[model samples]
Target: MANYLLIAASSDIGGATARRLRDGGHHVITTARDASVIDPDVVLDATDFDAVDRVVAEAGDLDGIAVFAGSMLLKPAHLISRAQYDETIAASLTTSFAVVRAAGKHLRNGGSVVLSSSAVALAGLSNHDAIAAAKAGVIGLALSAAASYASHGLRVNAVAPGLVQTRLTEGLTSSDMSRKVSEAMHPLGRLGEPEDIARAVEFLLDPANDWITGQVLGVDGGLGALRPRQRV
Candidate 1:
């Protein structure tokens, strides 16, 4: 059985991914900022590089690591406050970097690293300024880290998900009108579930998919690449 680390295990997608890994008979170590939530193996601030390094070091030979630390902010760039932008960047981009850095230093050869990005990072979406920027940084960081660590046999990839039905996104999906509008944006005609993205993360983390690296897997229900057809 392989060993894996999941940062921010309290998040919906993170919890789903952890369950998937454990069900496959792999050893999973989980972390979250809040100890009461999810009762993770570690209470961690994933954006803190020193804390991330310590976790990786203690894990003792990890096969894979995935960072699910992120946030959602739907506000225009012009209206976004300085603190909001900083928080967004720290949550997603900074946390991703911390994981990648730790993985590079500690993960075993041929190990995998998965990061969470967003469809808005690749496709244009209104009122997603702060989050889009942060997730976009994650993509760039993943690609570069993949390149840098390729020589050491480490694989790095990012999963970009579209609108997902989770506690974090309840504000956007709780209303019928908002839900329909969001669903209509995806060519698949539905919002993504946490399991959907979890499956993608599982795929990337599996040793069977070792050939894949430096790739951004879009788990966005066709939202990142396709334009939905007009309804008559």
Candidate 2:
């Protein structure tokens, strides 16, 4: 069984992914800003490299690190101030870098680094500018890390999700029109669930995935390839 350093386990996708790994017999050390909500062995602020290093030291040995700690900010271009945009970027991209750096220190020689991206990385979406840009960078970071860490026997990969029902998407809600439109955009005709992305992550983090690295796998129901206009 693997020992996982799970970041942001309080988030919808993060918590679900943590449970998924645990259900499959992995031990998870989680962290969120609020350590009391859930039992994260230590408190961590992904944006702070020093804090991340401190927590990694506390987690002892880890087989993998899942960087699923992120936030969503939907706003028009003009409305997106520098601070707001910086916050989003820090959460999605900067935190990822911190996690990778920490993993390089705490994870096992053949450990896994799993990060979360969004379909926006490859597609167009309104009000998603900040989040999308950060996620696109995430894809790049994962690949670069994969290359840099190969000699150390570490694997780096990313999973881009589309329209998963989570607190981040509360604005999208359960509207039938939004659901139908979004689902129709995907060739699979459905929105994603937490488990969908979670399973993909688990597969990539599995020891068997040692051969797979520096790849960005889409869990977006084919939105990256299909005609999204049909849904409109």
Candidate 3:
């Protein structure tokens, strides 16, 4: 079975992804700042530079890497200060960069890296300035990052999820109006589940997917494609 390095293992998406990999019999070394949030064999936050290095050091020769580290704080453009934007970038975008850099030495040749993005990167949304910017950078970083690691037969790609059911979206769960709005936003008439994105992550991480690199797959319940259009 393949081994995986799962950053943000404590997050709902990260945890679900990790569980999927584990249940499929792949070994996984997972990490998050709070050990209490994850039952992983190891715990470290990607945002913590030195701790992240240590975690990678301990988990050697991984077959794949899944970066699910992220945060969400919606606010009007005018209300989003530079410092807040930087924080979101650091947590959602910068952390992935650092994890990739750390994993390079341990990621086996021909292995893949999956970075998380959001459908917001392409679809317009209110109060999504910071996250959209960061996720967009993730899409941009994919090809360049793939280029840097191609010598080692490494592939990099990003997944842009839309309205997935997760802790990050717990607030929306309680609001029927919000849920209805979300459902209507996707032509599928439903929100994305964690498994939807998790399955996509699995495909991108599969070694057989060598030909598919430096791409962004939108696992957004048709939000990016069918949104802005009424479906009959």
Candidate 4:
């Protein structure tokens, strides 16, 4: 059983990943901003570098760490306010950097670090400027960190998921028209579930798959790489 830390466990994807890891007999230490919700081992604002360091310090001899802290902002670049853009970056890219920094200092050699990116980062989608930029940064960070940590046998990778059905996407999925549009965008003809992304994360975290590093696994139901077939 490997010891792992999951930041922002209150989020749907985070919770699912934590559960999946635990079910596989791994010891998962979870953290979230709200302690009342998921009862995580730590109540953390993942964007805070110092707080992230503290959590990493406490999780001794971890085999892996996954940062599931992120935000979704569907707005055109021209329409997005400075505050919204900053918040989006802080929630995703900044939080991811915090995890990377903490893991670099405290994680055991040969450990894994998995970060959350988005399909929008790989595929150009309308009204996704803020989130796309932030997630793209996550990809860059993961690749560079992977290179830096390779000598130590550490692996750094990311999962770029399509629109998964979660609270963060309730506004889009709850509406029939919006949901249909989103479903059609993915060649798979449906939206992704939290489990989809969780499985990818679990795959990247598995020590058996240690050969993989610096790659962005797209758990996006083909959204990032495929176009839907035209109906006759």
TM-score of each: 0.98, 0.93, 0.93, 0.97
lDDT of each residue in 92-184, candidate 1, tens digit only: 999999999888888757699999999999999999989999999999999999999999989999999999999999999999999999988
The number of the candidate with the highest TM-score is 1
TM-score of 4: 0.97
Per-residue lDDT tens digits of candidate 4, residues 101-220? 998888757799999999999999999999999999999999999999888888999999999999989999998999999998988888999999999999999999999999999999
Displacement of the residue 200 alpha carbon in candidate 2, Å: 0.9
lDDT of 3 by residue, 6-112 (tens): 88878888877887888989988877777776677776667776777777777777788889988887887789988998889998788888777776666655689
Candidate 2 vs. true structure, TM-score: 0.93
Q: For each candidate in the order shown, give its overall lDDT on alpha carbons.
A: 0.93, 0.84, 0.83, 0.92
Number of the top-ranking candidate, with lDDT as the measure = 1
* Alpha-carbon lDDT of model 2: 0.84
lDDT of 4: 0.92
C-alpha RMSD (angstroms) for model 2: 1.9
Tell me how far candidate 3 lies from the true structure as C-alpha RMSD in angstroms: 1.7
